[model samples]
Target: MGLRRLDIDRAALLTALTARDEGLLGTWLDLRDGTLRALVEPDDEAFEARLESESDHYVKVPLFTREFRLMAEFVEQVDDDELAVRLDQALAGPSAFRAWEGVLAADPSEQRHWRAHRESALEQWAASWLAGIGLTAPWTDEVPAPEVPALLALVMDGPVRRALGSDAEAHTTYVRACRDLCELLREPFPSRRVRSASRFARGPVVIERSGRDVTIRLRADDEAG
Candidate 1:
């Protein structure tokens, strides 16, 4: 009878690929049959010892740091300017990875988006790595762009106007815009930045969200008019 060739356990491999911690148990490919075994640090000492002896039946799974690209690409695609800026900050300095996790954890909305992005990247990354090692991916390699939320899309495409005007649709659109705009600026808006923005205003009207507060104010230019 011919040998049974099992497909690789892709989910486990993807987890290993995305691991940033030093204690990760490595993902191993089983030669006996196409499958995987993960050995995390400080656990399963018996398997760890036997791993070297069983090299004929297993090999270290192919690896890459492709998952690290998640934060970089996610920051670029973020629709919220403030959130994008925060993500950029988290991607820098010695504690970047931890900082990024903290930031993502605080914002559940963006965290969900981040997970979707990570999943797509992980799938593509695994599929590519599997291909390099002459294994067929159980899934497609095509990573679709992370979907933009409908409210965020509306905010980005919303018309920039001085007033909501009298139209019912305009009022409806403005309410939605206000809600989404608040999400973009969840913290206090500095007065200095407000002044800077006022200098460039087409009209002296600004709609702003500070924490949970939403306010409409007249700009310096329009204040005197």
Candidate 2:
């Protein structure tokens, strides 16, 4: 194992402490009180395992703490064999990013044709996740009725135009909505196993059922245009 001095940014810490989220506040207090030491000092295998078990929706302080802890382990390279095994385990699992990719892959429509629909679905999925964590934001309503190519292009490429076009406004709104949602969903944890057969559907679909009626919704790419 290799060890390196961990540097904490005092200004960033203070900023996080004053943030609105309670989770962030708790993380800052934990850092000040040295509760984060255990995460940073462990061997790479242990450190990675702990992180894998952590939820993705964390506040800034926890996010920073988790990142720093992982980085410390990376710097130390303790037990290459164990590290390799953990890395493989981590990679084999379904990650939030993987879900995002699955959403893209499940889309059967041409990229140029279904950009707006896909974008709308992505925004809605993210908003729903944020709401689950008590971060209530307005839902998006940019799913324009079926349109001609030129009109679609105008709407899809609205981000490129500074003018107040539907696409531009939609893109701006969706981007902000996604950012807020991302802050709430930064961690990558294991999702419930989705049925292999249902992986091709569009929008967000429930893939697997666990205890109760809880169904894990996964993003798929093949949404209706």
Candidate 3:
């Protein structure tokens, strides 16, 4: 199967991402097949199978827990500095991002700073990702001014504004926008050769991909936990 190129539309993705809640975006990527199925109907086997298939579809190389976890964190913590720091620690220690929830909840100043840091980081993260996919003008201050003067105009002042607005339906619009962004980000791996669900159990798997070369560097049995 041919590897799927990262070819999602730049405008649509930026729009969706900008309009969505950062927390929900994180939750979406962090969802496992079991949790995802529960988000819909847990008792439905067909639905569970489909959700599993969907994860495999976007990630064709059969990422071990290591790789999958990293990818999930990249998407989820794209805006979260505190979680990003903890995620790095989690790579080598027992402490994970979840360990910070109680601490941050108890400290309002830390929580505010954390939120501010995330927003700042998100601006950079979004710009970097857009540049990676070859769209450099979306977040800049300059304007082309045909339909809209600024690239972020449709995003910041449009759907995102409505999402953050005080209207009764604002929350619904915000949720829909967030879900759209999550789906786009989770759009299946481009390869047709979807691996079996069993491969997910094979850890400590190390994965590296450049172009179409996706390699799984398996660890020794002792380290595969």
Query: Which stretches of candidate 3 lie above 4 Å from their native place?
Result: 1-99, 141-225
Please give the CA lDDT of all the candidate structures: 0.57, 0.33, 0.36
- The candidate with the higher TM-score, 1 or 3, is 1
- Superior by TM-score: candidate 2 or candidate 3: 3
RMSD of each: 20.4, 21.1, 19.9
Residue lDDT tens for model 1, 71-154: 898888889899888888888756888888888898999999998888876777566545434455665534333334343444
Regions more than 4 Å wrong, model 2: 1-110, 138-225
Tell me the tens digit of each residue's lDDT in model 3 across 1-225.
322134343344333333423332211111122121122222455644565776543211111112324334453534557655654554545545455544456657656765565454444444443343333433453322222212223344322222223433443343333333322332223222222111211223323232323333444456653
Q: State which candidate has the highest lDDT.
A: 1
The candidate 3 region of ten consecutive residues with least summed lDDT is 28-37
lDDT of 2 by residue, 1-225 (tens): 222122333334433432345322233222122233222322455545444564342222323223223323332442456543444444446683343334435433422233444344344433343333334323332322322323223334322223234644544433333332223343222223212121222122222222222222334356441
Quote each prediction's TM-score: 0.51, 0.20, 0.28
TM-score between candidate 1 and the true structure: 0.51
Error of 2 at 182 (Å): 18
Model 1, position 215, has a per-residue lDDT of 39
Best by TM-score: 1
